[model samples]
Target: LIATILLYMGVALFCGCGHEALSGTVSILLNYFDVTKGPGGGLDVFTIIDILKYIIYGLAAGFFVFGVLLLVEGFFTTGAIRDLYGEFKITACGRCLTAFLMFLAYLFFLVWLGVTAFTSLPVFMYYNVWSMCQNSSSMEGANLCLDLRLFGAVTVSEDRKVCTGTEKFSRMCVSDELDLTFHLFVCALAGAGAAVIAMVRRITLSSDCS
Candidate 1:
């Protein structure tokens, strides 16, 4: 167990070490994702250290998958299936524990999804667009002034005039509501499936139920 944990930690470090910093618009998203901090790198830069932020995160997630595989593989070799000291077999207990815990996890996830779907749903639906607008407009996707002109958002000129129909100096605000709106569906579906597991059942601690 100790060795496996150490191995995982080592892999994690290696995965992060090569990633170098970047700047500019890419860095803007990276920073927002908490991939890197501070200002962007000075200018065009490249090296072994300049690892793509997304790639680093992907590799980190992969390391976790590998670590889980290692842990589960331990189960068959040294886990529930294997006997210790030729006297005790913990396979039954381990199996029961695993099932019970997994079911609980499923239920918890469902409840969490339901809650998140409720929260981010309205913000992206255009009804709540006013919350972001500096003015009285409460429409979603209201920040396309410089991009689109026919939307509900408003932009102003240098003299405080409403940008009613011109595209000179546009004003816009960005929102993740649309993306969250889509995610709401995915979360709802997964949550409903998890609910189908119904309630968690009791697992027998021993190989025999009696």
Candidate 2:
């Protein structure tokens, strides 16, 4: 039960931090690039951002409910609960429910794994930009550029380059927003990993109990 609580804490952390980091990332992209008016694309940046925001919101609510259900299930399976309530017999329905939950937990683990990897892509991209800023003194003559097109932020064929030599790029690199967003994403990643482990443990425990 204690382990389950700790794991849920990680899920809570991921939901909160991931949402904030995603907002920050969108803000940075919109502020620096022309993502709002990408030519020839059916979907605008605003639409995509809105979709992602909604998805995160749904995930937060879903996880909270699921976590509560899992906690209750864990409590019922514990020796303490059994002692207090007397030996509870597992019926066919109970067994089926446990099996279903185990499957769901495994599914969530896989989903979070994908999410963690997706979250890392932005962190990786931002890290490269930060690295370029750090080595700006040495690479004086190089045209250090970050293209939004590569990341699918813009569909336009025109170059949306944020170079090291530009004032906007320098300001962005030095800004606390960038640092905060990066750290938040990192925290979110860690949280997702913890949640994955928790889900795996939950599945194992459920299988044993069943």
Name the best candidate (by TM-score): 2
Candidate 1 residue 117 Cα shift, in angstroms, is: 46
- lDDT for position 106 in model 2: 88
Compared with the true structure, all predictions reach lDDT values of 0.37, 0.80
**Per-candidate clashes, comma-separated:** 4, 0
TM-scores for candidates 1 onward, in order: 0.26, 0.90
Q: Please provide, for model 1 over 104-186, each residue's C-alpha lDDT reduced to its tens digit, 9 standing for 90 to 100.
A: 44554454355335423422433333333444244344433322112211122111222322332122223343233334433
Error of 2 at 91 (Å): 1.2
Q: Candidate 2 — what's its lDDT?
A: 0.80
